[model samples]
Target: MTASMTGFAAHSLNLDHASVNIDLRSVNQRFLELHFRLGDEFRALEPQLRELINQRLARGKVECRIGLTMPPAATLDNGLNPDILERLAHWQADVLQRLPGSAPLSVNDILRWPGAVQTAALSQDALNEAALAGMRAALDELVESRQREGAKLKQHILDRLAAAEAQVAGLAPLLPALAAAQREKLTERLHEALGEAGHERLAQEIVLAAQKADIDEECSRLATHFAEVRRVLNQAGAVGKRLDFLMQELHREANTLGSKSVAVETSRASLELKVLIEQMREQVQNIE
Candidate 1:
């Protein structure tokens, strides 16, 4: 199935003491571009996270943001650090002995001191596992999101492809008529300009002009390119660049068809084919 290079996914994983949150944002690009916005503590995960993303995604500018959200203060104060309490006691005793007029440290002041309380620390291994799990889930959601959008883009391109194909198909039937009419018009003009003195010249000039103005080859090439575009769209993985190349080919054929056109029918068909191909090109830019 076709996938797009644009999507978004956010995931949160709850742990014993905190929660790990991850957000993945992707946008279309010519090559795979990965960026990470991780907290200082989680910076170590970047290398592994980068490798995982590279393995899964083929092309896009992807942004991965990871953060840890701690629990409430009350929940975190699971116990008191005895070392901190003992250190505070020694400091207070020294201060009182140095100045008898100073008051003693209160229970509230002791509890409010830095490092007074400690919670069960989350191990690096646990944090890493939780973060990787969350990232895996987020990536899954991101891929699904991209696939849904890609389905829409594929349908859009297919619709325009049908219209362009119809234009090319319509051109083939009009070629013989267009060539005959152009030759007849040129013959009348040449006959009037040359009269009897240049009969052989008129015949040769009409034939040469008619041959140059024939758009049959251009139409055939356009149809062939259209088929190739459809074929590429159906194949798996990273079809955007290929489809883009085919769009160029389609546009080239359309331009040639227009230049060779000698009648309004062929000219209008050329213009419409260009329009449809441009529309398809716009959607193809997002496909993967």
Candidate 2:
């Protein structure tokens, strides 16, 4: 099924002693645009994450944020650097010997000392693998979210399509009557303007007026365009661009129908078609 460009998904995974959290958000855009917000440690993974997103999505302005958290006491040593502590202890002993009256280092002072504790770097291979797994989970959820929105968009577009089709259908039965009325009115005007000697001119003007008022061709083409819209909607995968183009075509037909309209009902139907097309255009902008 097709998907939408608007969606959001967040996922978190615990791996080893750290947690990897991913947030994905997307919105409609003419093209795929990706941005990442990752902690320094995971910054190098941006390229891989981008590649995965590009493979799955065709259009959107997408943002990805990665948060990594390490528990306070995940390791046995609690991230303490023993070598640095030993060096500090040696320095403190020398200072006490040299200055005799110096206060001993308190437990708070030891804990606050630089290098008293350090965070261990996780294995690169392991972090990468875990991050990739977490990303996959988030992406799967993102796709499902987009798909659900796409389904709603499809229904909305289909509804407008039906309304536009109904407008076109309503115009059909009105055409013959409108055309005859237009011919009679134009003929009367021509007779008044050119007198009885203008019979030839009146006939030509009537035929020309009838031809200008003809919208059957526009209506037929609109029907065909509607059918194509349905077909594209039902087909799988990124269809936003295609649907957008169809919207323009549909709008063109509606405009032409309005221009050729000879009756108030036909003109109103044409206006309604334009309204419906505009609504569909907005919805199709987000289809993927």
Candidate 3:
């Protein structure tokens, strides 16, 4: 299916004592570019996260921002650590024996030590796992968003493609008539220049000039390119580069038709073809 390079997805993971929010955004770019705005605790997961993104996306400027929020100390499920309490007690006794009248450690101080509160603080492994899971879920949504946008882009391009095809087709039937008129004009000019003596040479020059004015080859190649674009859009995976190249080819043909214009009809058709090709090219820029 076609995929656009622009999308957004956000996911949140709630752990025992904390919550992680994952936000993934993508925009159009020539290649896969990744930017991370993870907290320090989640920095270790960057490499794995990068791999996951690369596995799923082929092109875009992707940004992943993960925010971590922790509950306040007042709200933690608190409990005492016996080992820490014993160490603090021993140190307090030593200090009292030496200083005789020194102020003792407060009850609040003992309770506030590291590991003092049995806040089910997340372990590294647990946090990492949850972040990864959240990332995966966000990616799923991101891909879906891109696909939906892509569908719209594809339809837009196809509509312009149809218009461009009509422009080319309309010019086809008029070509022979245009060629005949151009030949007669050329023959008249040559006769005026060289009279009866230049008949043979005039016939040769007319043949050469007619070949130059023939837009049949350009039209044929344009139709072929159009078909290829439709085919590419149907197949799976990245197609932006291919579509971009096809746009160049289409533009080239349109320019050729304009350069060789022998009548107002052909010139107008060339202009219309150019406008339609430009529209399709703009839409293709967002495809993947």
Superposition error at 39 for model 3 (Å): 1.0
TM per candidate: 0.83, 0.84, 0.84
* TM-score of candidate 2 on Cα atoms, chains taken together: 0.84
Name every residue pair that clashes in candidate 1: none
Off by over 4 Å in 1: 73-75, 78-120, 193-201
Q: Flag the better candidate by lDDT, 2 or 3.
A: 3
For 1-288, candidate 3 gives per-residue lDDT tens digits of: 999999999999998767889999999999999999987668999999999999999999999998766666633454566677888899999999999999998878876565554444567788889899999999999999999999999999999999888888888888788888999988887788767776678889778888898888988999998999999999899999999999999999999989988899989999999999999999999997
Query: lDDT tens string, model 2, 85-158?
Result: 89888999999999989998987787666546554667767777878888899999999999999999999999
Model 3 residue 167 distance off true place after TM-score fit, in angstroms: 0.7
Clashes of each: 0, 1, 0
Quote the RMSD, in angstroms, for model 3: 7.1
- How high is the CA lDDT of each candidate model? 0.86, 0.87, 0.89
- Candidate with maximal lDDT: 3
- Please give, for residues 1-288, the per-residue lDDT of candidate 1 as tens digits: 789999999999998777999999999999999999996557899999998898788999999999877666644456778899999989988999999899999878876676575545867788889899999999999999999999999999999999888877777776777888898999988888888866788889899988899888887788788889878888988888889999999898888888987888888998998899889888888986
